[model samples]
Structure formats: C-alpha cells, structure tokens
Target: MNLDTLKQLDLDDREISIYMTLFRLGPASIRDIAGQTGVNRGTTYEILKRLAARGIVSYFPKGKRRVFRAEDPERLLQLAEEKQNALKHTIEQLKTDIIPGLHHLKPDFSSGNVSFYEGDDGIELVLKDILATVAHQPEKSYSVFSSKSLRQHLYRPFPNYTTQRIRQKISVKVIALGEGGEDAEYSERKWIRTQGQPDASYIAIYPPKVAMISLASENYPVATVIDSVEIATAQKVIFDTLWQLL
Candidate 1:
C-alpha cells in the first residue's frame, strides 16, 4: 500500500516502488512497469525477478513482450508466517549454542572510552548507567547534580530507574547547586545543595566503579564518566571535601 508497508517485508524503496506499481498497473512489460513506477528499466527488472523468486509475482510471455503480475495478497501473510517459523528455529538453535559461545565472548570496554548519543536517547543512557550503579551499592553512591542547561527535559519520562534504585535500597547522596535543588523536587531523600553558578554542571559519584560528569546543556546532555576504582575514590574524596564545605 505504501513504501512503509512494503518496508515491513524488508523491501527497499526501489523494490517497493516496482512491486506496488505492478500491483496497481496489472500485467505489464518491464519497460512499462518501470515508466509507471518512475524506476529505471534495469532496476525494475531486477526487483521483479527477485519478487518472482519469492513466489509473490509471476511472469508469462505474451507475444514479444513479457507481462508480470502480482500473486494473491494472501502470499504476504504466508511469507510472514515463514519468517516467524524461521526465527523460532533460529532462537531454539541459539539456546543450545549461546551459553558456551558467551563464555568465549569478551566485551572490550576501553579503560575510558567516549560514546556519543543524541537527544532523549542520550539522556536515557546516562539515567540507566547512574541508576544501575546506585542500586548496586546505594550507601556508597553519591550524585552532585547541577543544571547548567537541562530544563527542557527535566521532567521527561526516564525509564523507571529511580524506582529500581529505591527497590534495591540504594542510598543516594545528592549534592545540588543552590538553584539546582530548587528547580526540581528529586525523590532521593539523601540530598545536599549549594546555590549560585548555574553553569557549573553536574557530577555523579558511584563507589568502586563509575563517576559521571554531566553538563546540563538545555538541548542535550554531555558527560564523561570515569569508572576506574582509583578514579572513583579520588572523585569521592573531592565530593567529600565539597560536601563538608556545604
């Protein structure tokens, strides 16, 4: 019906255009089909050949010209069923192989690496990372929150990370800039605040592992996390010194 509909079957733009044109135009030669679809003759022919091999199209010779016709639309349903069965078989095979295979798989996280994500997706990543660390070790987890620029999405939906942290009995230490604390009503009962300097940014301290240094840019968030135990303790020390002054 539409390019989007065809794409669900994994047909790209050209394939979809050609196939849909054939469906609308009835039996026609490759050249006519291409003209009707606004696709080149060669590409239309190739797509039709692929479609024919899938048994959703058929071709027959009529005089000197070849005509192509779409199979009944019910074939689309059958194709989807075939895919479902194949995925089930593959998943069953994966169950047999995944355990031993996983033992051999090693994820390489560079000592400190940089990853870039845009918009709300980026914020979600930061939220997940922070919450997991908090739940893992609540008492030792601390956050120094500042909102240099994070007003637009301050109240947006974050994936139930806070609830998870609370359920795990993670103790959170929140240190906010003076106005930063006033801006949002954070549920973390253990919190500290300071006023002034709205552009100073936010810092998160998680014990034994990661510390996230996030800047609250109004449009997006930018943060660098240091996960080395050595680095995390050094950060905790800095936070302690700051906490004492507050």
Candidate 2:
C-alpha cells in the first residue's frame, strides 16, 4: 500500500512507519513495532495511541503486554468519508457565519488601504481579487484602461480569466490603449489611437478600489491595490471622459 496517501489524513512519518510495521507484524507489542520501524519505544507508543484514536488501529491484551494491530484496511474509507463531512460543515459555517463577520470589520474611507504585490503570481492574485469583489456586488460592471503589453503578460498566467469572468456574468468597459484585444461575451472595448503599442500598464476601476498593474519591464512585473472610494470615483470619472471621445 502507498503510505504517502495516509499523510493527507494528517499522519506524520513516525505514525506511518509504526502503523505499517504493525500491519506487517500482526498483533505485535510496542517493543517489536519500535524495533522493526527503527523508532524509540516511547514515541512508537504515542503514535499507536493516536492511530487508535483515528480508528485505524486497535489493541488487545496479550498476557502483561499489549498487542497492537492495524484495523481492517476498509476502515480507511470510513475515515475519508468522515473527513469529507467535516470539510463540508466547515464550508457552510464560513459562508453563514465567518465571512459576514469579517465583512463587518471592513475599514471605511476615513482609513484607506494600500497593498503592493510583485511578480506574475502577485498579478494573478490581484486579478482574482477583482473578480471576487465584482462577484459580490450589486453593480457588476467595471472599467479598464487596457494595454497590449499588459494583456500579453497576464494571459500566459491566467488564460481562463476572461472565460471565468463571463461565466460569473461580470461585465467590463475597456479603452484599449494600443491595439490587439477583442471584445468578449460580457465586455465592450474601444481603441485609442497611439503612436505605437503603448507601454505595459493596466488600470482597473471597480468601485471602492482601483488596481494598477505594471508589466512594462519583463523581469519586474508589479501591482498596487488601493482601497478608497474617493480615488476610485476620480478614476472612473476620467475613464468615462476619455471613453466618450473614442
């Protein structure tokens, strides 16, 4: 049996070793299991107690010594089912209790928030945050200042972002700074005449937050997220003004 899978159930290396040793030796005392597994007797006894609590091992009296053995392998399936149920309950509790409580703790405009991120992975996180925020809002439309260079950098890491956004029924209005992006199911795009392909920077204006991503330097992609209703409102006004001329 591949013992690596047992690690997913929170078993440590010593626990796995002792359990496998008992499975092989059948109803053996702690001293025999410890000897076979090369672990000290005290630690082996502790692991046996934990496995018994997990219902994967059991013990019986063999004279003055206690004999430990692995329970039926089928017991592993039962344990997995229990873990699944526990995870499901946890998700429900978060949705009903935890998330709402956290939202209530959000800071107002008197105290604005600023966050910085670096590299491709950080950019992807910003994009996902945009999607998640839009998903929960009453008005799901956002405006964007898009650039060809920035799109190329992000598409490699998040190829399915547009698809996911469309699936969520989120909509975007974009002013493509240079050229080479197309309108998708839930998006509208207008192009601005530029001398050449514009430098790689992206600005997204979603109410209460504005995200700026710079991918102009291939080796040093970075992003900044600002949470302020005032800043977002100003950016939205500017985008709308430029959007009308194009």
Candidate 3:
C-alpha cells in the first residue's frame, strides 16, 4: 500500500515502517516488527508507542509480551483533520495575538529602514511583499519605474506575479524607462524616451515601502527594500511627476 500519506499526519520514516509492518504481520511483537522492518527492537518499540499515542496503533497483552496491532486506517484521516483544525486555530491566533506581539520586537523604522537582498530568491520576497502590502491598502494600488533591460530578469523568481496581482485585484501604474513592457490586467503603463537601454534597474513604490531591484554581473539579481513613509512618499512624488510629464 502507498503509505506515504501517513507522513502528513507527522509520522516519521521509522514510525510508518513499524506501522506498516504491523499491518502485514497481524498483531506482532516488537521483535517481530523489528525483524521485518530492519529497525532495531528498541527504536521499533519507541515508534510503536508513538503511533499508539496518536491512535494509529493499539496493543494487547499476549502472555509475556505485548502484541501491537495497527489501528483502523481511518484513524490516519482523523489525525489529518485534527491537524488541519489545529493549523486554522493557529493562524487565527497569529493574526489576533502573535503578529502584534512580534511587531513589538521590530526595530524602529523612523530613520528609514533599508534592507538588501541578492539573487532570484531574494527578489521573489520583495515581489511577495509588494502583493501583501498592496492587498491590505484601501486603494490597493502601487507604482513602478522599470527599465527594459531589467524587465526580462525581474519575474524569473515569480513568474505568476502579475497573475497573483490581478487575482488580488491590485492595480499598478508603471513608467517604462526604455520600452517593451506588456499590457496586463489592472495595470497602466507610460514610457520615458531614452537614447539607449539604461542600466537594468526596477523601482517599486508601494506606500511605506519601496523595493529597488537591479541586475548585477552575469545577469544576477540584487534588490533593496526601503521602509519609511518619507522615502516612499518622495519616490512616489517623483514617479507621479515624471508620469504626468510622460
């Protein structure tokens, strides 16, 4: 049987092995399960006890030793449901209590918070932050200043970025530095004339934050996020002014 699904219930490799062995051996001793599964008797006994605690296994006295039996397979489904409910409660608690508590530990951003990141993975974090920040805003919109050279590498880490933004009903106003941007849902674009392809860089002005991404040597990506109302407002004003001129 495909027993991999048991892992979702937090069963480790040895626990699953011991449980499956019980299913096959029909109420076996620790020695019997250990011999079949190649796990030592001590580890197998420990795993059986863990599974028993989870209601996935049970045992009865058989003279000198205990004969452990696999509980009904349906117990696995019940365990999964219990975990799901626990996770939902945890998320609610995080929203109501844990997140606010954690925020108290954050450093002051009054002097302008700046963070740097490198590589595609780092860029993806910035993109996700954009979506998350904009989604909560009353206006649900942000602005961008993007260069043509940087456009191709920008979304490598997050190919579905536009799709997610559209799904969230977030809108964007973009100022294309050197042309070649696509029309996308909930987005408006304007262009700035340039003599040649400018150095590859992108600026995302989401209120209280601005993310700047650029390509380094060998087309590697580097990014910085600035978190401060003053910095973001200044950037937004410049973008708006340039946007109107364009």
Name the top TM-score candidate.
3
lDDT of 1 by residue, 159-222 (tens): 4655666665555555655443432223442244435445645566675555344444554655
Local distance difference test scores for all models = 0.66, 0.88, 0.91
Alpha-carbon shift of residue 63 in model 1 (angstroms): 5.2
> What's the candidate order when arranged by decreasing TM-score?
3, 2, 1
Name the top lDDT candidate: 3
Give the residue spans of candidate 2 off by over 4 A: 109-112, 138-141, 166-169, 216-219, 237-245
TM-score of each: 0.57, 0.84, 0.91
In terms of TM-score, how similar is model 2 to the real structure?
Answer: 0.84
lDDT of 2 by residue, 27-105 (tens): 9999999899999999889889999999999999989999998999898889888899999999999999998898779
Residue 116 deviation, candidate 3, in Å? 1.9
